[model samples]
Target: MAMIVQARAADAGAIASLAEEIWREHYTLLLGEDQVTYMLDTIQSEDVIRQAIESGTVYWLVKEDGELIGYVAYDLRESELFLSKYYLKHSFRGRGIGRYLFDELKQVAIENRLPAIELTVNRENTRSIEAYRALGFHVLREHVGDIGGGYVMDDYVMQYVIS
Candidate 1:
């Protein structure tokens, strides 16, 4: 059985390590090795993860049989939940883990009275986009934002409206 635990400051290192592993295995082809290295070093660093947790970004570590398998992180904005990260090990894909995690996200949104959950996914990530669509998410718009190092995130802003 899979379980979710709220991550603390102490878990930042674990999260960062998993992020590096997952990003390298999953994103290397979609985004070149250089970009993957840059993203893991900056956005998914232990320091940044720790800071985000301290700043009220909620993170949950997903575990199965006492082994960490993945993680999810989100922030409660004024009117919606911004899902910053949803990553699992490549071997853990094709199971129901993604949907299980998303169900948890829905519960959190309801508890917080958020009307929607939003996330940005790389436009080329067709598998993830299809998964999100299966969970009732729809594309709201396209976004291209510079994230330093001359790299711009070209993504589709997707949203799931809570009813």
Candidate 2:
């Protein structure tokens, strides 16, 4: 059975390590090795993760049998929860872990009185787009943002309205 634990400052290194592993395994095919390397170094570095946590981003680590497998991070926006990162090890995909994490986030939305949960997913990530759709998310819009280093994120803004 998988369990979710709130991440702490002490878990920054583990989170960064997990991000490196997952991003390399999954994003290399979609974003290319160069972009993946840049992203991992800039966004998923331990210092960046710790700064994000300190800035009110909530991270939850998923562990099974005492081994970390995945993590989800979100921030409470004005009236919605903005899901910034949701990743699972490639080996752990195709199971119900993603849904489990989504369910947990829904509870968080309710508790915080957020009306919706929103996230931006790479438009090319067909599997994740389908999974989000399956979980009642709809595409709100398309976006492309330059993240420096000559890389741009082409993504679909997806939202799940909480009723």
Best by lDDT: 1
* Candidates' C-alpha lDDT: 0.95, 0.94
lDDT (10s digit) by residue, model 2, range 14-88: 999999999998899999999999999889999999999888799999999999999999999898999999999
Candidate 1 Cα outliers beyond 4 Å, as residue runs = none
Question: TM-scores, in order shown?
Answer: 0.98, 0.97
Per-candidate total of colliding backbone pairs: 0, 0
Candidate 1 structure quality by residue, lDDT tens digits, 1-163: 7899999999999999999999999899999999999999889999999999999999999999898999999999999999999999988887999999999899999999999999999999998899899999999999999999988899999999999
RMSD of 1: 0.7
TM-score, candidate number 1: 0.98
Clash pairs detected, candidate 1: none
Error (Å) of candidate 1 at residue 15 is: 0.4
Candidate 2 C-alpha error for residue 148, in Å = 0.5
Off by over 4 Å in 2: none
Worst 10 residues of 2 by lDDT: 89-98
